[model samples]
Target chain A: MTRIINRQPAPLGRLVLATLPFILLALVYLLASDARLAENPSDKLLPSMQSFVEAINRMAFEPSRRTGEYLLWVDTWASIKRLFTGVGISAAIALLIGVANGMIPYARAPLSPLVRALSLVPPMAILPILFIVFGLGELSKVMLIIIGITPIMIRDLQLRTDALPEEQLIKAQTLGANSWQLILRVVLPQLLPRLIEAVRLTLGSAWLFLIAAEAIASTEGLGYRIFLVRRYLSMDVILPYVLWITLLAFITDYLLQLLSKKAYPWYHAQLGEK
Target chain B: MSEIPSIQPIIEARQLWKEYGEQVVLERINLKVMPGEFVSIVGASGCGKTTFLNLLLGTQQATRGELLLDGQALDPEPSPERGIVFQKYSVFPHMTALENVMLADEFAQSALFGRVWGSARKALGKKAMAMLERVGLGHAASRYPSELSGGMQQRLAIAQALMKQPRILLLDEPFGALDPGIRKDMHGLIQQLWQEQQLTIFMITHDLQEGFKLGSRLWVFDKVRHDPQQPERFGAQVTFDLPLASEGAKQAAAEQLQQVSNPTTISKEQQHDLSNAV
Candidate 1:
């Protein structure tokens, strides 16, 4: 007679428990969609699974009438290019500035205050300014994502570097490491995995900024397509696009986590014990 | 103090004092340490035993006097000439035990890269492996510090420190976190390494028995004067300096240390006499 609080589920039971909410939500959506469509066949909201599947098929497999290109693939590639470019630049800048800020007082004294202040400012508030400065091109959209996430990632990495045990630094110095060597060898290797983790954490916000920028000004992108179709109440296309973006984010996060675990097994091992 | 040997002292501290603003931590510490002497220091917590180790390690500068290494002023920064092992976090968690040992040579040979490659890396790996075998962590060479047990990690730390071939080794309670059984094994390993390397060692310990069992010389740090109003006004000094080269001297010093440490074992009158004698 185990108490409910103390009751434990077996592996199969756990799997069923994990998917229960999603299944329930899907069932409710199907019932509501059926009811709406029965009353009004042309209902735009909560499209049926059949309409969703047809919309996905047209977007993914068929060629567009105007451009003769699969619009879905084109939009995905465009968005991914901007996302990765912005995130890549952010990662490089965060690594260099963050490690410097953590290890050197001189580096920290000037930049840390500036980074802290920048992180406090709402990144979305400056979207117009970024668009004005960088123009309504790819640069502005990429800049938005970079500006949104770079400061946060830098602050995260700096704290991680600062949190490194003082003993390791001393031990490295005693082992004849110069300041540069200390940063390059002892500090950089350890902070790289942390940078990956920080990037993973910030990917969601990066997507938000990217989509906002594209929705405002873009020729063709997932966000642009979704926003363009919103006028006609194309829930089928828009809902699938949203789900696609979510799937992409999940896959990217999973890959980065796998990279961290594989490339830096010692980091994960250390985490497990400490 | 015993008579100074004719051989040139490897390290000499002349009126060393460390003060933090108005507070004193260590005061008037003067000593002449010959080469290859295993000096074990024991004191109550916050008596500046670790501070003395830091001064010797060149991580902390003395406020008032000179700390000479090889008859020259010791550098204000740590270098390969002096190696140190802290109680914990001494080993790099990101590195395998073998790579940790090889790090010293890598830093020395490749100043810019902090690593060697190809043939040079292979050769260094072999040398590091030999050192690992000496410390008895050869089998766990590929294991990360976290994967190894505490005793093995400390052995890895010792092996890493020895890679630089330092003349002096500073250990700040390196075995404090270890279980007693594991600690004994570490002691044997350290003693073997010390003797084999002819290393001049300075170890700080809270365990009096460990201090007596290991060192050729024992240093007891205690305050000569205490202020009832302000404890920070007075600083600790080497109150008891005993050379344990002879068995009789070791036994007598152990008894004295026991009495000083355990006040319940002695009457108040005897305790008063002991403090005055110190």
Candidate 2:
């Protein structure tokens, strides 16, 4: 009998195995679209590949007569700007709060409870409250993403810091390191890579909050454009926009992983990851 | 072991007691250690061996009494006067071997940045590289701890610890995780370092033979009294302090070693008593 547990695919075979599901998915989509279009040429549920192509060209290639700008590019730029701004600020805040909560008892006593309480509250449920406080502008949209993900990132980073071996800290102290020196030298460098991992994990949620906010109140964003066409049941435009957003998220996640690999090879090495 | 009356002890513990809430870990430990002594400690698991080492390293403070160094009260915090190497995680994983060694000098010279650049960095690198070579890790200067073997990592940790030129070195089961073959090499390395640097060393070991073979003085930590109803009421203390320089103590160590090796000949209770009384 063949040993299933011990068997693993070779590199080339693994690549083929990886692509098999995606190819099957596309084929299924194509066949379903063909069947739907055969019944009714103008069906909105399953738009044909030809309609998808035409929608992409109109949104990406042609400038609108009223706005005189490519709609897809404009929306993409707005969405990306808001997403990165929110994530960047959250990362900065998480670093400070996490280090404080992990290292010092005085800071941890109060801040840990606060972060725990904040992380428990559902971020989407506070949409109206955020709009009322920050107003319906870019600030409110960015704030929504921040409010959604910052506490979680802070908790993760704090736990990572707390999990560092006690021996390392004692060794640093024995080497004549003061409090600030220990933080700058011993703790910060180890934490940078973990911060990146935290960001990578929360990027999905950040995108969710961003899209939700933009769909509620915005003039030009990927979420806004998708919601704008949904009134007429324009599946062709909506489908491509969703695919583009997925592609962007995939690229961002990929680049973050690559950056982590290049910047902190020791982390991956310790985890025994290639 | 005759001693000069004018000579001063490097470390002295007077009625030292370490308690955690209601549980007593170490109790009434009083001893004096001269400079250039290699003291090996042996005990059972959870017997407060590491706690004693931490007390020496200044990571943990005694609940009562005094721990002194150089005729002054030792600080309750870790300082450069005492350096320590643990069984694991003593060296920073984020740094290369050279960088780890250089960190001591960095922390000393640049308090704010914890870094030095330009010519200062170059000079520090040279010194760190020399220290690494002394520890037999010169060829692996740029390698991170993750890429190193267990023995090599321990050597790197030793190099990092010695960079501050601490007078007292505390090693907490540093060779316990190593293979037998690697442990012999480490023993040789440690002996040579202790002699060359004039370092007072305190090492904890579970191996009784290793404790006898390496230490100039041997200490066995065990509870002299135990209560079945309340184990936390008692704490470990130095039950045996043998100065191995004397011929009589050396002969006793050999007999104890034989008794330990041939455990089936004696009752388990006798063996426990023998270990405590060694």
Candidate 3:
């Protein structure tokens, strides 16, 4: 009986050694910046730090205000709620349309050229059209996000579906699988890994589009807050929102990858080997 | 082998003709495989052995012949009556070994949903597990195909094909990718499965030794030319049939098998046949 053990993990010492260059660069940067800060302590550094802290505190605690003379502060909960609703609806629609298009060859073949053409058209190019059709409401914003992300999702699904191993398809056909069965059972399972990857890519693209969508006639969302602060040249307020969005993207991408590994362990093992 | 008498031919191909474009692969090929019979089709590459298996499995259409299953003409539609295992990795890579086999069983019982309830799914899991055990892969049942070694993956493929309780099993070079030792083991497993399930198997192999070891009857295709003496014979085609049982049959079979196993052994007769096979 042959037992295959996993390859040994790299030693901790060697792992630390591998990070030496990045660690050294960070140390150099910290030392150089620290010297400048120490030499010019009277350059209103305390007030700048105080302002940064106040912006974080404000975004975390106080909710945003829409009208004038009412000091508005964006809260974390509102930002999260807007992100969840916007990304959730956009991803769901994109995934459904992408998967449906991928499964039907007739649809994919005729629609692929149109999709390719549409993908080339920037989301911003059709903002005016969307604004006129759906108005400057949440529908337009969500539609913009869908437009930005759908092409990528469709292309990914199409490529993954096409890249399925010929032998597996033949085997499924020989096993009495109909087209639907083949797609759901054999093809979809094989597409799971790529679909997860697509989700990550789409998530990032959705976030990118979210900011733009929010900047355009949007009342809610981190994007709107960032845009509003940008008008005032209040970099402090904008910086926190940027950091929050970055953190949110990182967390969502990480969660998606984690789910992918759990759902398709073989993908993780193969990737881990590489 | 007393149970053999109770078994009947499950797969019958009558005058099967398969052509692709201008090239005819199998012409007027007739074969009857009895239940529990381990029939191996041995030929050089491009002799249409795989095509014959496809026809039997109903995955392909015969150009001008009829294929019958248990006295009925095989439906062009796919059915659970025939299961096929391929030479390459056909097991769904995203699925575990058990899942792969279970999926086949589920597909087979898709119509019995009202009567079976969730029992069918449970039974499928149990059956898949039993199949894994039979193939000596019970411990690796949870492992995905890509996680398994090449030989193990092929074994999983075999299990998946057989899990459907198919009346006839079609194997196209099932062990063609395995090493000699693993191939021998897989052959033993296949033979055991055939006996246990009373399965009618039509296996295609380029390996002469595999044909000898597993095939109850070996079908060989010899190339024929209209003008044998012509320096460049133009009208050439394959004439395939079961090898004749003669005094020199065993020796000739071994020689041909050797040529197939080792291409460098390319004897003059084999080369002549190969040239005419085109």
Kindly report the TM-score of the first chain in candidate 1: 0.98
Better of 1 and 2 by TM-score: 1
The residue-by-residue lDDT of candidate 2 on B4-77, one tens digit each, is 34378888999999999999999999999999999999877777888988888887889998988877898889
TM-score of chain B of each: 0.91, 0.89, 0.77
Q: Compute the lDDT for candidate 2.
A: 0.90
Candidate 3 similarity to native, TM-score: 0.78
When sorted by TM-score, best at the front, the candidate numbers are 1, 2, 3
The residue-by-residue lDDT of candidate 1 on A1-93, one tens digit each, is: 889999899999999999999999999999999999999999999899999999999999999988999999999999999999999999999
After superposing the true interface residues, what Cα RMSD does each candidate give?
0.8, 1.2, 3.6
Question: Candidate 3 regions off by >4 Å?
Answer: A1-51, A61-83, A93-102, A106-114, A270-274, B1-15, B28-36, B111-120, B226-240, B243-252, B255-278
Tens-digit per-residue lDDT, A50-138, candidate 2: 88999999999999888989999999999999999999999999999999999999999999999999999999999999999999999
DockQ metric, candidate 1: 0.87
Candidate 3 docks at the CAPRI level of acceptable
Per-residue alpha-carbon lDDT of candidate 1 for residues B1-278, written as tens digits (9 for 90 to 100): 23435497988999999999999999999999998999999877788988998898888999999999887898899988899999999999888999999999999899889999999999999999999999998899999998999999999999999998886899999999999899999999888988888999999987666777788898988888889899999999998898876777776775576466543223455445434433
TM-score for chain A of every candidate model? 0.98, 0.97, 0.76
Report residue B60 deviation for candidate 3 (angstroms). Answer: 3.0
